[model samples]
Target chain A: EPEVTQTPSHQVTQMGQEVILRCVPISNHLYFYWYRQILGQKVEFLVSFYNNEISEKSEIFDDQFSVERPDGSNFTLKIRSTKLEDSAMYFCNSASDGETQYFGPGTRLLVL
Target chain B: SQQGEEDPQALSIQEGENATMNCSYKTSINNLQWYRQNSGRGLVHLILIRSNEREKHSGRLRVTLDTSKKSSSLLITASRAADTASYFCATDLRRGGADGLTFGKGTHLIIQP
Candidate 1:
């Protein structure tokens, strides 16, 4: 089965540095989402994207966060400045009609 | 902020036994989905029960939804050691907005050999 794929299975960056997490959702999927899970915490929604624009975002997705589908196949999340609290497992998901969401293996972000 | 909260934070069952986990939500939803996640991994979609549906079964897994009570249950019968993982229930609200799924803390299930 076709599945969502993410690059840099793990990322480590300085506290004030910028970092980009990339994902390639299923080719035919229209809705894309980003979620994060702090260690030992529930997964939290970050943002959703459709038509190359942000549909909705949570408080955690402040000015420091931005998502882009720079190409037909790549969905990237950029953090302008990383914070220690931002360290978590970031997951990328895609769904056709908001029914069943397929998730990627996730990228573990560690902000030092 | 309405999310599915699963009960019995953790469960330990013997192989070949049945394990049941319950989830409760606070809002009307279009569908309820169950997912499994291995430690440090991504979520794996297990099953989805729509609002209009009451029960569904796939393989040895069974799920029942009670819309009136705003609760759902997932049962895994004749489970194996591989079934050990964290199970989460996610709610997909009916609103047409950018409503992403809200997940609960999840239940850590461990199957003993």
Candidate 2:
């Protein structure tokens, strides 16, 4: 089965540095989403994208966070300035019907 | 109470035994989804039960949704050692699939061989 794919499986960056995480969602899916999971914590939604624009976002998706579909295949999440609290496993997901979503392997972001 | 709160944070069962997990949500939901995550890995979609549906099955997995009581259950029957993983129940309000999912803390299952 086709699945979502993400790049830079592991990343270590200094605090205050900018970082961009990339994802390639399933070809035919209409909705894409970003979610993060802190160590030993629940998965938290960051943002959802559709029709080349953001459809919904959470409080965690603040000024420092932004998501874009730069092209037909790539969906990117950029953090203007990394914070220690931003360290987590960021997962990209896509769904064709909006109810069942497939997830990527995730990018582990570590800021120190 | 938080949305999509699961009970029995941890469970240990022997191989070939049945494992069941329960989740409760605070608000109205259009659908409920279950996901399994191995340690430090991504989520694996297990099953989805719509608000109007009472039960759904896939392979050995069984899910039941009760909108009136605002609860759901995931039962993995005749499980194996590979079934050890953290299982989470998420509530989706739909909003045309625009809204984000509210996930529970998850139940950690251990299937001993």
**What DockQ results do all the predictions give, each relative to the true complex?**
0.72, 0.83
- Across A48-109, the per-residue lDDT of candidate 1 in tens digits comes to 99877898888899999999999999999999999999999999999888678899999999
Chain A TM-score vs. truth, each candidate: 0.98, 0.98
Error of 2 at B21 (Å): 0.2
- Please report, as a residue range, the 10-residue window in candidate 2 chain A with the lowest summed lDDT: A94-103
Q: Who wins the lDDT comparison?
A: 2
Please compute the TM-score of chain B alone for each predicted structure, in the order given.
0.95, 0.97
lDDT of 2 at B64: 95
The docking category that best describes candidate 2 is high
Residue B56 shift from truth in candidate 2, angstroms: 0.5
lDDT for model 1? 0.93
